[model samples]
Target: MNKAKNVTISVYSILLFSIALYTLATLIYSLIPNIPVNKLFAMIVAFTILYLYIQRITLERIIILLFCLFFSIYTTIISEYSSDNINDLLWIVTTVLIIGIASDQKFRSGLEQAIKRNKKWMKMIIIVIELILLMAVITPSSYGNDVGWGKDASYFVGFATHSHTLASACCLLIVLIMTVYKDKKISLMEYAYYILPIYSILFSGARTFLISVLILIMINVYMKKNSKLMRNMTLLVILSSFIFALFNSSMISKFEFTSNNVYAKNMLDSITNGRSEFWKYDLDLFFNSNFFIQLFGRGFEYIYNYNYLKVGIKIWAHNDIINNLISIGLIGTLGYVYIWFKYINNFFKRPRIDFSKVQFIIFMLFTLYIVAPMLLNGLYQYQHYIFSSVLLGQLISQRD
Candidate 1:
């Protein structure tokens, strides 16, 4: 009884500490607009290491994490690099995840209870957050959606190199929503909750994202039943895509935001330069650059800057497989693939879905979906990193 009580208290304290620390960091980031966010992250990681060592944590776990760290660093150094800094960032994130897995394991019982407490509220919270953020984005100044039609585009708010990236993110979010809530019954209010964002997605005017939505809808319907719903969704997807293309082909027809974005256009433009030339150039760069890179990998998306597009040389090597090859090489990205398949096997074929199973399934589906886009195009860099990390954190939390 004493041991259980002690363990429970320790778990509560840890959860409290985590939330407090995150809140502090978020506040600091908002306050200090000039300091790079990564610097703050580095500080947190350094603090975690010190805290764990002081707490007399087991050396065995640390050693395993160190192995992961070595592989992470090893991968980072070998792959084709657009900029040394982004490569470092990739390795840092990977290492941090390793650490998170170890740290979160200590107080698993209490944390698991707390996580399960939100079953009813989670979907509502997500919907509310999305609406608030969307209103902020679409309104910009909050005056109103006035002046001109598309100029309401914030016409100038450049997030990633491409204007269409947000639409792609919306598509990805929709996939997740469908995955989580497809047949599950909620309420009429919840059904309305999903409809609004989707309507917003249609208005976002991203052809490829629309295509992805179509694919997700078809698959979802197929899973439920190969009936009229599947046929209707397929028909709607085609018609919607066609209508979007007919009206807004010009949105991506020329595709020129890289040079104009805050993050210099050099790298983004290079990747967008198209298959024939960009792949030819990047492939030679990946394979011939180093023997080690060819053997294992450099790391995921380490190539940062060479992805630019010139005016005359409008090209694109946006395919994910080609990009992964150039950046992580064969061996590195394959681990990601292995992880996905492993999780998928457990999610569908396995008998149970207690906490860890659901998280694993979510991550696997997301990781696989991101990989799928690589063959077609490359609009995933920004969103993939964040969502993959989110899913990974959830898994680590559950395992704890």
Candidate 2:
């Protein structure tokens, strides 16, 4: 029985490590811009899931996975079935299966125990992520030119398709590091690890993530009293440096503070960065459509088929809520919202250790990072979903 348990734990460890590797590779592809890293990683993940399924078939896991698969198939059949739509459908199915596996009681327990036993490997993963981000920061590329820091320098995308994704990943990384740090006093090197990711988010020039990180830092300061001085000083330095960088870069020119009205107008414009226009167009399209279209949505290919804005941009709704409504209709949007609420409720209800107070706060902050821009952006990519699932699994794991 002990040997069997060891094997189970080893299998789970390998699964999680593979997921992390996939995420890292995806980030690297973003920086290099030539590799089909995500596709290759997706194939590996699919096979891993198949292996897990064949090794341990359970009624509950199958039911949940099938529920997600049903939606994927339904949406694909309803849409134009273009490569993009099919890829999206596949990603959704994969995400669901991964979440289902991570959430399984036995699997999650074994995974957590395996992780605890393999702290060095986990640390190596973090180191790899940090090194990749460092490489992205140093490497020059044309990415993020559209909404990134003006022509002066490209906003940091850091192995992500966009700045926002990088910011979101950074936010998630910070939360994970902080969760670990909360258990014990971390060295200055570890503190640097936390700072690097936060700095990367700032460098990305993603307003939503920057704002979320600020709020998180403030809350951390208030909640943690043991190392108050050092924490505040570090935060102060980070904020000061970020402000200095913004003023030195082209970002300052985008803001107008000549007067209160100008300041307000510019602030709104800067924050929204024309996203309000996208939202307005999406809302108009949704409202002006026929009953069936509005209720059931025009499918995922709606934006590609119908250009309500006439902007010629191939992308559809920029906002997650609006995108869901436009792509999946009202029915799907409600279900989407319910899933998030249920996840949050379940997370809070789970029994946790004393350290969970800090963990909960970090989780909420991460959720805000996920939820805030999602109001203006679409669903997070596959890597983000995997990272989120891992965090959720850790949170839901039985107390050690």
Candidate 3:
């Protein structure tokens, strides 16, 4: 039993280590962009997670492996086995493992045990992440120079590859911190830590994060079932946010990046940052496809090629509903619908709110996710994958 427990903890540590390494690599990449940090980290974490997963495989695990294999073969065959097939396979495998690890009851339990077993190591990892988040705002980075919003719309990406990446990371960090510290009353000094991610999101210039966070705040406040500390902190955020908005209208107005675009007067284009165009284009393609293709999806390779051929840009639909319709089809999109149904079902079945519970965090994260992916290619992004795993894990591990 002890041996098995230790193995579980070890696997959990590997996941945590991967996240830490990824963040550290991002920071290092800002200084030395040519380093093979990404390659090394991917190879190391991939091998470790795959080995651990196979060693403890069950019938259910075999079924999942077989499904992934089948999907890979189908997509590869359909797409003529392009190089992108390899990347798609890796992404699917990593996503499976992330969600699998999170959903394991023994693994989740071992997280607490591991914290007690080696507090220093866990604290070190947390401290490293905290420092990185702080650096994202205080020092900032030069890499997030995006002209998509507008030529003059410069963003503060910090150590992340893009402004959106930094914004997503900040959102994830906020949820994780709140979930971890849910049971305790955070001191005023400790509560100040929330400002780091909040400010980081603003400077990153991702309105998706801004709007999503606002919705989360509204839901939490309306429920009004959180801890005293959480309530107080939420109130503090509201007060400070008002003050900041009042004094820093110029900074807040930076989100209006579509002011100079041809669609400047178009409400839909302005609000969606022009994603509605991509969404409509992809939806048209999906509708024009044969019934079978519409049911099962056109596959990622097909969508990639089709988008490039149509617009000379290899990109997604920027909307998960449309992305899923084209890539995974209506059948796969229904899986997402089921997830929503389950969350809403659970929400209404309860007499009171989960409040600052991990479930609450998961609910809020999912809420934000539903909004972000509509305008950004967020469904398949690594940061969202990590948080999706946490959300899935919480949903699966908990009982009605």
**lDDT values for all models:** 0.44, 0.61, 0.58
Candidate 2 regions exceeding 4 Å error are 30-35, 46-63, 95-107, 141-153, 158-161, 172-182, 215-270, 288-295, 304-309, 351-363, 392-400
Query: Candidate 1 or 2, higher TM-score?
Result: 2
RMSD of 1: 8.7
- Ranking the candidates on TM-score from highest down gives 3, 2, 1
Instruction: Compute the lDDT for candidate 3.
Output: 0.58
> What digit string (tens of lDDT, one per residue) describes model 3 on residues 1-400?
9897677777656655565455556544555677857546656666666676687788756765665566666666676666555665565456555444444455556545543455456446556777876665566345345546555545677776776666666655554444444334434544465666666666666666676555444433433446767776776878677457634632354556654445334677666665666567788998999999888776666767777776566766666677768866786566544544444345434555445464565465555655455446545445443553353334323422
Give the Å shift of residue 149 in candidate 3.
2.6
In candidate 1, which residue ranges exceed 4 Å CA deviation? 1-67, 75-84, 87-115, 120-124, 137-188, 199-208, 215-276, 296-320, 351-368, 377-380, 383-400
> lDDT: which is higher, 2 or 3?
2
What global local distance difference test value does model 2 have? Answer: 0.61
Residue-level lDDT of model 2, residues 48-82, one tens digit each, is 77667767878866775556665676677688859
Model 3 poorest 10 in a row by lDDT: 391-400
Tens-place lDDT per residue, model 1, 249-321, is 4333223332243323466443333344466666776767677777555455444445453223323346655
- Candidate 3 colliding pairs: none
